[model samples]
Target: MTDTRRGSIQRLDNIAVVVDDFEAAKAFFGELGLELEGEATVAGDSVDRLIGLTGVRSDIAMMRTPDGHARLELTKYHSPSPLAGDPQAPPNVLGAHRVMFAVKDIDDIVERLRPHGAELLGEVVQHENSYRLCYLRGPAGILVALAEQLG
Candidate 1:
């Protein structure tokens, strides 16, 4: 880690996802309106080399949201391994995680994604904090959330 000055952190840059097929993952996310930013390889000695006795030299894809701030990075390990999927339980399960996006028209967005093959996980609920939210499983079991904060 670099020893930088105080208040060095300005903002969030990106999020990453490891995918088996780069083109397919990009296509899936592209349908949701995120644009492809670029692609690259994790080339360096300092990175991990062995995963369950398999070598690790992988290619990756980087994508960005429409606003051009947050990012989605997809990486695929060349070696075979157990497939990745949603945790065998609800979001309350330990270590379970999902990405949340604040949207203006949650209902409209939900409707729009139906034709693109998104599965509605649950009905939108009004929370105690004046928030309306819902869960949807998008391409490749990706858990996406839409939230409208009334607070």
Candidate 2:
């Protein structure tokens, strides 16, 4: 592990994505090789106040990568209905753009995700001899990127 510097952040715990279908989102990430960590319903005064919302109740599915280095949290709001946003917005749009994952076979992973409504934002392209990459819009129109390293 790298030495921690004073005033420096330690590490990223997880990335959260709000979805409309809890099951579908779980399955989508499952197909991409993320193992289910657990499921839970979060609510109560603390959660509501933390998110700046009242009466917040949501179902969450936590999935971690096979290496256990990355985690993705999928949420489905039950109370104080989730706000609307442009999930289908192009990559150029602002805000949290996309989440990228490294893969062994980009084609195989792409084929598997297609059955779960994964739509390619652009054709898989090779970058020099370093990696092959592509971006796809997954459930909830979330943009996901896949990279396959090449030797």
**Candidate RMSDs in order:** 4.3, 1.6
lDDT of 2 at 131: 97
- RMSD of candidate 1 to the truth, in angstroms, is 4.3
lDDT of 1 by residue, 42-62 (tens): 644444543333444678778
Candidate no. 1 TM-score:
0.70
Stretch of 10 with least lDDT, candidate 1: 44-53
Task: Write model 2 residue lDDT over 1-151, tens digit each, in one string.
Answer: 7767778777799999999988899999999999999999999999988999999999999999999998999999999898888877899986856899999999999999999999999899999999999999998989999999999
Which pairs in model 1 have colliding backbones? 17-73, 18-75, 19-75
lDDT of 2 at 34: 97
- RMSD (Cα, Å) of model 2: 1.6
Query: What's the C-alpha lDDT at position 84 in model 1?
Result: 70
Q: Pick the candidate with the highest TM-score.
A: 2
